[model samples]
Target chain A: EPEVTQTPSHQVTQMGQEVILRCVPISNHLYFYWYRQILGQKVEFLVSFYNNEISEKSEIFDDQFSVERPDGSNFTLKIRSTKLEDSAMYFCASRPDSNQPQHFGDGTRLSIL
Target chain B: AQTVTQSQPEMSVQEAETVTLSCTYDTSENNYYLFWYKQPPSRQMILVIRQEAYKQQNATENRFSVNFQKAAKSFSLKISDSQLGDTAMYFCAFMRLMNYGGSQGNLIFGKGTKLSVKP
Candidate 1:
């Protein structure tokens, strides 16, 4: 079965540095999303992207966060300034459309120091 | 706002036995979807099963089945003949049904229940 794939399975960055997490969603999928989970917390929604634009975002997806579908297959999440609290497992998910079940990637573990 | 709650933090079952994980959600929308995802030690989220709110028939996948109580806003997953491989963190999620006018479906996930199956 085709699955969502993310790059840099694990990422480590300085507190003030910028980092971009990349994902290649299933080729036919039309909707993409980003979610994060703190070490021992529930997975939290970050943002959703469709038609190359942001559809919705949460409070955690503030000024520092941005998502881009720079190409037909790549969906990327950029954090302008990484904070210690930003360290978490970031997941990329996609679905055929709004009514379909969203499929998740293995996740990228982001570590900030 | 929609929220998913999984009150059980941890549960254990003897190998080859059965287990059930509970989930509840707060959503006024009549149309939505509920799901159970399994995350193994690899930490990869895998969809176990899904249930559509409009469908009264419960969903079942092999040994994995669900008791979906639409009126009570509860969705529980039952794993029959549980095996050692079943040890993982299970998450319950909720998402609103997609509308025709370009609405995105975002999942609201519960905290997760850690299931350990012993031999």
Candidate 2:
């Protein structure tokens, strides 16, 4: 019942500015992941992290995107220069082990103006 | 690469009725996992049910059950005695099993089917 929580449920930023989406995964979870869902589109994987390093990333996770576990509990995704196309609902997920299913946060709706 | 497909874009069922959402995937790996996630108006992804490829028996959780055909690469979710709360967008996802030292599991999701339970 421990859920992943995300802050700033709604974020609006200028096109060229930087933005950071924060997530607090389940306390005991080991793997963390980021996913994007454009309006009316399928959810797409952005990146996955484990053991304090990135395990894999999709093409959408380019030079402008980076993720870090700044502390033990917080996982943050920073976009250096936001583009209009970057506007989407970003979801953070975590799981306790290999065979366990990933639990998702409520999601942060990022809107670029 | 693995891909999950949900052919039905939208569906509706009367309250207390039953409905099934279809899903199919294209994958070469023998060992993997399939799942159904429900995203209500809140846009929160909630796990509905999971089916392991190695398991021959289908997974059932109360009113929610899965009809998994491993050979056909088909996995579908059946909701019995549906209610208004069941009105949500259902997504079918696929994930390859993780190796001890390999990459972490990442879900490949379908476009999703919006189910509306009308009272």
Candidate 3:
């Protein structure tokens, strides 16, 4: 199975600091997504991007959240001024196309101290 | 709004035995997809199996298969001849088919069921 690769398997940052989580999706995939799973909680969708723009986003993707497919290969999720509650495992996923299954990355464990 | 429910929070099965994880969803869309993903201690969400609503035949991958009841809105995963490595948190998810922006694959997941394959 093709895998989505995420950078910095784990990250520790202080509250109020910004954090950037990077992902390298499968080359042939056309759509990308970002999701978060707080410890002991279900995974929640944050946003989905395609064609260099956000196609859809959940309420969790507020003003502090942003995503970019910088340089056409790297997809990044940036959280500005993180909070303690921001601590969670952020997962990146990409799909070949519509109606196809989306594959996930190993995830980046973000710990906001 | 669509929601997935995994009634069983935790289930235990002996190695070499079979265990089934329950998942029910609420959706009105006719065309959609249901999936089962396994997350081990590593936190990697691995796709186990998926079923398309249009297909009446169940989807199977080796020992992992789903009992998809579209009319009942139930999609349950049955792990046959389970192994120790099968111990993990299993999540059920739902996605609506996109008429446009198909690439924006948004998934709504269930709370998840923790499966323990005891050796």
Candidate 4:
């Protein structure tokens, strides 16, 4: 079965630097979402996108965070200034339709130094 | 606000045995969806099973099955004939159904129960 793929399985970035996490959602999927799980914690929603615009976002998705489907296949989440608290495993997910369950990517582990 | 709770932080079951992971949620919406996701050591999130609120019958997949009590807001996963490969972190999630034109929805996940299947 087709799956969502994420780039740079692990990323180490310096504090206050910019970092971008990339994901290629399943080809035919319509809705896209970004979630993060801090070590030993529950997964938390960051943002959801559809029709080329953000549909919803959690409070954790602050002004420093932004998402874009810069191209037809790639969905990227950019953090302008990384913080220690930003370190976590970021997962991208997509679903074909309303009734379908969201398929998740392997996840990108972001580590801030 | 909707919240998912997995009271058991960790559990263990012998190979070929059966184990059940508990989950409960607080939601006011009448229609919604519940799910179980497994995160193995590799840390990949994999969907295990899903239960729709409107469906009276529980959802099942192979050795995995759910006991969903809509009135009690409880959804638990049962693993029959468990194997060592079943060792993983299990997360229970909740999502409110949205209209067709709205976003599909984002998952609200529980803290997760770490299952250790001993051989």
Candidate 5:
């Protein structure tokens, strides 16, 4: 089965630096999403992207966060300036069509120091 | 806004036994989807099963099955013949059926239940 793939499984960055988490969703998938989970917390939704645009975002997805589908298969989440709280496991997911179950990637563990 | 709740924080089952993880959600929308996802040690979120709100019958996959109560707004997952491989964090999620254009549908997820199957 085709699965969502993410690059840089583990990322470490300075607190004020910018970082980009990349994901290659299923080739035929049209919708993409980003979620994060603190070490011992629930997975929280960040943003959803479709048609190369953001559909909806949570409070955690503030100005510092942006998503882009620069290419047909690449969906990326960029954090302009990271904070200590930004350190978490970031996951990328996609669904083939509306009302379809979503498939999730292994996730990128972001560590900020 | 929709909220998913998994009351159990942790559970354990002996190998070959059965386990059930509870989940409840609050959603006024009539059309929606509920799901159970497993996150192993690798932290890869894997979809275990799904149930459509409109379907009165529950969904089952292999040893995994769901007990969906639409009227009570509850969706629980039952794992039969639990194995060591089944030890993982299980999450219950809800997604509204709204069309956000092409493929992007937003999902609301519960806090999750940590299940440990010991031999």
Candidate 6:
């Protein structure tokens, strides 16, 4: 079965540096989302995208965060300045436009130093 | 706002046995969707099963089944004939049904129950 794929399975960056997490959602799906799991916390929603625009975002998705479908296939989340608390497992998910279930990727573990 | 709670932080069952993971939610909306996701050691969020709130009949997928109580706001997962492969961190999630112009379904997840299947 086709699944969402995320690049740089593990990423390490300096506290003040910028970081971009990339995801390639299922080719035919129309809705894409970003979620994060801080080491010992529940998975939290970051943002959702459709038609090259953001549908909704959470408080955690503040000024530092931005998402884009730069091209047709790639969905990227860019953090302007990575904070130490920014370390977490970032997941990308997608589903068809209807009532279909959303599927998740293996996740990219972001570590800030 | 909707919240999912998985009370059991850790549970274990012998191989070939059965185990059930409990989950409850607090929601006022009459219509929504519930899901169980498994995150193995690799930490991939894999979809396990789903139950629609409007459906009266329960949902069963092979060895995986759900005991959903709409009134009680409970959705529990029962794993029959458990295997070592079943050992994983299971999460209960909720999503309000999307209106034509609502936010794309964003899943609100629980802390997760860690199931250990001992051989």
Looking at model 4 chain B, report the run of 10 residues with the lowest lDDT sum: B96-105
Candidates 1 and 4, the one with greater lDDT: 4
Candidate topping DockQ: 3
Cα lDDT tens digits, model 5, A1-113, are 89999999999999999999999999998889999999988999999987778988999899999999886879999998899999999999998788688899999999999
Candidate 6 lDDT tens digits, B1-119: 89999999999999999899999999998878899999999999988999989899999999999999999999999999999999999999999876563436999999999999999
Q: Which stretches of candidate 6 lie over 4 Å from their true place?
A: B99-103
Model 4 residue runs over 4 Å out of place are B99-103
lDDT of 2 by residue, A1-113 (tens): 78899988999999999999999999999999999999999999999999999999999999999999998999999998899999999999999988899999999999999
Full-model lDDT for every candidate: 0.93, 0.96, 0.94, 0.96, 0.91, 0.93
Per-prediction TM-score of chain B?
Answer: 0.96, 0.96, 0.96, 0.96, 0.95, 0.95
What interface RMSD does each of the candidate structures achieve? 1.8, 2.0, 2.0, 1.9, 2.5, 2.1
Predicted candidate 3 versus true structure: per-residue lDDT over B1-119, tens digit per residue: 89999999999999999999999999878888899999998899998999988899999999999999999999999999999999999999999886563535699999999999998
RMSD of each: 1.1, 1.1, 1.2, 1.0, 1.5, 1.2
Report model 5's chain A TM-score. Answer: 0.98
For residues B1-119, write the lDDT of model 2, one tens digit per residue: 89899999999999999999999999998888999999999999999999989899999999999999999999999999999999999999999985562337899999999999999
Report, to 2 decimal places, the DockQ of model 1: 0.74
Model 5 clash pairs?
Answer: A31-B103, A31-B104
> Looking at candidate 5, what is the lDDT of residue B1?
80
lDDT per residue (tens digit) for residues B1-119 in model 5: 88999999999999999999999999888888888999999899999999988799999999999999898998999999999999999999988876543234677889999999999
Query: What lDDT score is found at residue B109 in candidate 2?
Result: 99
lDDT per residue for candidate 3 within A1-113, as digits (tens), equals 56799998999999999999999999999999999999999999999998899999999999999999989999999999999999999999998888788989999999999
lDDT at B66, model 1: 100
Clashing pairs in 3: none
CA lDDT for candidate 1: 0.93
